[model samples]
Structure formats: C-alpha cells, structure tokens
Target: MATFATSEQLLVIIDPAARQTDGESVRIAKDVLSAGAATKVCLPDGPEEFARALGRRGSRRPVVIGDDRALVRAVTVLHRARELAGCALSVVPVGDTALAESLGVPRGAVAAARAVLDGSERRLDLLVDDSDGVVLGGLGIPPEPVRAAAPEPVTAAAGRTWYRSLVRTLAPGRPRLPAVPSPGPSRLRVEVDGAAVVDLGQPVEAVSVAPGTGGLARVEVRPLSVGAEATPVRACGQTVTVIGADFRYRADAAVSGPVRRRTWRVAEGAWGLTLPTGS
Candidate 1:
C-alpha cells in the first residue's frame, strides 16, 4: 500500500456532470481543496477533453470531483494509459456517490474534500476486460430480467417493468456479485479460470461477477428451474468468461454489451484510492 503525503500537489479535474448536477457541492469541494494544497483545476467540457486532462496530468495527484460515472471515467483513462499504478486517486462525491461510498470514501463535499487533503492511499482490486474496459464494482449479466414474474400473466409491458425493478435492486455497494435476476432465464456459457460453471444447454436466470479477495473474482450463475428455485452456482477465480447469444451486462453503474462473449481478469491492487486514515 502506498502512503499519501500531506500537502501533496493536486490536479483536480471537475467533471461537467458534477458541475451541472450540484454546483454548490462542486464549489465547496473546490474551495476546500484549493485552500489546503497547491491545486490545479481542469473543467473538461466532454469525454474527449476529460480524457485529455487526465492524459496530461504529470506529477500532481489527480482528484476527481464528480459522480460515479466521472470516477469510472478517470480510472478508465489512467488504466488505459498504463499510469494507474503510479498515482493514488481521490474523489469528492458530487451527484451519484454509490460507487464512491462503497469504496469507503467519505460522503458530502466537506468531508470528502478533507479526505482528499488528509487521507491515506490504499490499493484496491479491479476487473479488466478483454476490450480494455475496467470494472470497479459488481457486474451483472442481462442487467435486468427479461422475463415476467411468475404467478403474473406474462406481457411485454410487464416484463419490461419487472426487469427494470430487478436492475434497481442491484444497487452499487462493496464489490460483490449481484443477486440473480427475478425468474427470467437466458442461455449462456459461464467459465471461471478455465473451468466451466454452466453451459449453453442449461438456461440461466442471471449471472454476476465481482472482484474478490486474493486477486480473484466471485462468480454466480442462477440456472433456470421448473418447479423449484434453482440454487445459484458460485465460483471464485482470477478470470471469468461468458459467452452466448448477444448479452448485455451492467458493470458498476453503467450498462454495456450485447456482445456474444466477454472475458474479465482480476488485477489485484491495480489502483489506489484515497480514503480516511486507517480505513
């Protein structure tokens, strides 16, 4: 674990979303941070400028003042540039903070900004996909159920509403596998560290994977059943792969995919986060 030095120089990148969503919070964070340390602030207008700001960050510590998406975007940029290991990341929660709080950062502008100035840096695990994307929280297959709840007559509209509800329940928290979706199943092949956990012959209600201890990932697959609830098959491994008909997944707070196959490998302690001392 790397230790952060007090009074370290900072490169503060305030995401546009943060500014738009909660200008007051953003202002408070800025005021507190600038008052304590030598800080350089960058206000990027869009994704391209955001990436550019991070790419050019030299020796200063990068502190993101934004929501969960902004935090993810910062990490993604640093990871892709191969510079993630060199610096500790800091975030001041603005707008959505589920992912930040889950990772142990203090909530609110004053508290989080204080963390930026006085916190310690701790290494954390993350998932890196074959496509170079990263997952800081849980990943859920299908994101939501595609089937209607049993006991209720199935209808296209009902299925949509039910699925949306299912997705909402899997809110971000400490990185862990998400719960199986309610009742609907899709055919998929799931493998962990090269061993098959489930195959295409069996339909699955849902699949989830998240970073786990010892540089591995926790995987769970809920197989479809007829008259009874199917027990979720679970596994832990350094790598997880999923394949089948075009499938979508929710990683952290973002929903992505429709791809036939995707593989994720655990990168243990791949990044550092600034948190309260002794956290």
Candidate 2:
C-alpha cells in the first residue's frame, strides 16, 4: 500500500530579477517549496524564456518567484494563449512589490511560498485594453510627470536673468522676471459603458480607473475648476473609452502611450490567483 501523503506539484519560474536580487530570499522560497511539493524549477533569463517556461508547464501548477512585473508578464502570456482562465497562478514577490501589495499578496518568501502550497484559488476581474495590454492592479491617466530634463547649463541669457535679479535687489524700479509656464489640465472626452460622462470642452484634473467585482471598472473623473464642494464623478461600467490629444497612462508599474485614444473593457473572473486561505 502507498503510505506517502499526496504532495502537490508545482513548476516554479524564477524570474531574472529574483536571481539577481535577494538570492537568499529566493533560496529560502525554493527550499520551502521543494520540501512541500514535487518541484520543477525554470530559471529564465528574460521575457522570452519566461514565456516559454510557462508554455511548457504541463500538469503542474505555475508559480512565479519574482516581483509584481513578473506576475503581470505571466498573466499576459497565459492571457494571450487563452489559458489563463483555467490555470491558477501563485507568486512569491521578491522585489519592489507595489502591485503585489495592492493585489493583497502576502509579503515574505516563506509565507508566500506556503500560501502557494496551502492556499486556495481566487478568480479575479481584469482590464483588457485595445492594444491587448493587461492592467492588473489599476491605471492612471496622465501619469505622474517624469523629472524634467536638466536645464541648459546656465547660459548667457540665464546669467543675464540672474544679473537682472541682483539689480532688482539693489533697485525697486526693475520689472519682475517672467514665471515659467505650468501645465494646464488635460482635455479628454470620457465615456463609460456607452454613456459620455465628460466632453472634450471640459478639462479634467485627473482620471483613475480600477477593476471592480461583478465585471465592472470603477471610473472617476476630477473636473478642473469645480466649486470647492464639487466632488469627482464616480461611476461603474463595463467599458471605458478616452479620446483626446496624445497622452500616457501608468498601468501596474509601466507607463504606456501618448496615443490619441484608448479603451478598456472588463473580463469578469478572467483569471485565478492562489491566495492564502481566509485572505
């Protein structure tokens, strides 16, 4: 008679980032996982190998041992193959994990690996874009600005401007220097679930969209120059479309676009993630 307790089997894909950073953490996770499961490990150097590693995942649960971006990459691969819905994914975050934190994945290699061994699967909603891009956590319109390019090493004109300022310090009759122009609010035509919420003529302070339960994305638009009491417009819908001048948005950890238009629709319970029990 077979006396060994049945052990779960897992294919652990160790991302390049995990191998490069916190090697000890990765080792701990590997040790714990090996002890609990029948393990097959794939150390991929880049995205191509990563996808291939997952593609060859046969009869084994796929587990990712990297940070948030690694999780997104795995999801995208399975998504493109249309296999995500049937496959459950587990992640052991080992790098900057803003995405993991937002998705409620427990931190620490040991705990996360344990979750992989003992946790249950939870089906979650997703936002799929027109470009076939996937948004795991959420997306922001007109992403936080990048640091401006270094000023032209103080040239003659700038020196003259400084001289003018010094002269003004000695004389009250000098004209004040011109101020640098700040950016104005963005102009976008926002639509939700076939209803137009804001038009192009209306400038917006900010835009945010996040996945919600039951196949919907929570859409919010902050209008520019509204009264102090005017709150942002918030609604839930299945589709969100934005049209305007070229703009960019931050999705997960990456920034995309300067495109004229973008649309996202919800796919309900599109994928399953392994989460700690009672979590």
RMSD of each: 9.6, 13.7
Q: Model 2, range 249-277, lDDT digits (tens) per residue?
A: 87876778788999999999998888887
Q: Indicate the TM-score of model 2.
A: 0.83
Clashes per candidate (backbone, < 3 Å): 0, 0
Report how far residue 252 has shifted in candidate 1, in Å: 1.0
**Pairs of residues clashing in candidate 1:** none
The 10-residue segment of model 1 with minimum total lDDT is: 145-154
Give one digit per residue, the lDDT tens place, for model 1 in 1-279. 556676678999999877765666788999999999999999998899999988888888999999888899989999998998887899999866888999999998999999888888888999999999999988998785333324323358747445533533454322333543543578999999999999999999889999887899999998887898889999999999999998889898787877999999999999999999888
Per-prediction TM-score:
0.85, 0.83
Residue 274 miss distance in model 1 (angstroms): 0.6
Q: Compare the candidates by TM-score and give the number of the best one.
A: 1
